[model samples]
Target: MTPESARALAEDYFNGGRPHPLDIGVYTFDAGYVAWPREPTPGDPTVLPDTVGGACIVIDRHTGEVSVRPLLPPELVAELWPDPTPR
Candidate 1:
């Protein structure tokens, strides 16, 4: 899938049907996309306790399959893409 579409899917998967204060941000990667929650405004300092230890959402490039993985650096998550073991 294209990066734009992948990003949209990830955003929806991350935020859709959920009541969340923080917005979801997606990072593109060769393997797929990494999605994580972030403060809506930078340096807002609003405590998002729920975001602590939140899993990063990974979307497959080819299949658009979404998976939840432990929170990690985007590069590291991309490098370890397509992890077979479910979170």
Candidate 2:
């Protein structure tokens, strides 16, 4: 999923606006998620769907608080929250 579409979905369905789901295969990282719509195609279903996107906030595994944006670029993610270990 492209970052653009992910951002759009974040603004749209993050707060029960679209029944957003917050977990995925090997990537359960938050309290919100959006299942998204399936695309029409003629291929294997094992391949994960595209466009279905949402946001996840990285938190301290122990503290359980918002730490970083998670899965985002360092700069952008850092903007949301400071790096646990900075230079």
lDDT against true structure, model 2: 0.39
Q: How many residue pairs clash (N, CA or C atoms closer than 3 angstroms) in each of the candidate models, in the order given?
A: 0, 6
Q: After superposing candidate 2 on the true structure, give the runs of residues whose Cα lies further than 4 Å from its correct spot.
A: 1-17, 20-22, 25-55, 73-87
Please tell me which predicted candidate would have the highest lDDT against the true structure: 1
Q: What's the TM-score of each model vs. the native?
A: 0.72, 0.26
For 30-81, candidate 2 gives per-residue lDDT tens digits of 3322223223563887888674543444433334344323344434444444
Q: What number of backbone clashes does candidate 1 have, counting pairs of residues 3 or more apart or in separate chains?
A: 0
Clashing pairs in 2: 20-33, 20-34, 21-33, 21-34, 22-32, 22-33
In model 1, pairs of residues that clash are none
Task: Evaluate all candidate structures by whole-model CA lDDT and list the values in order.
Answer: 0.75, 0.39
Q: Lowest lDDT 10-mer window, candidate 1?
A: 42-51
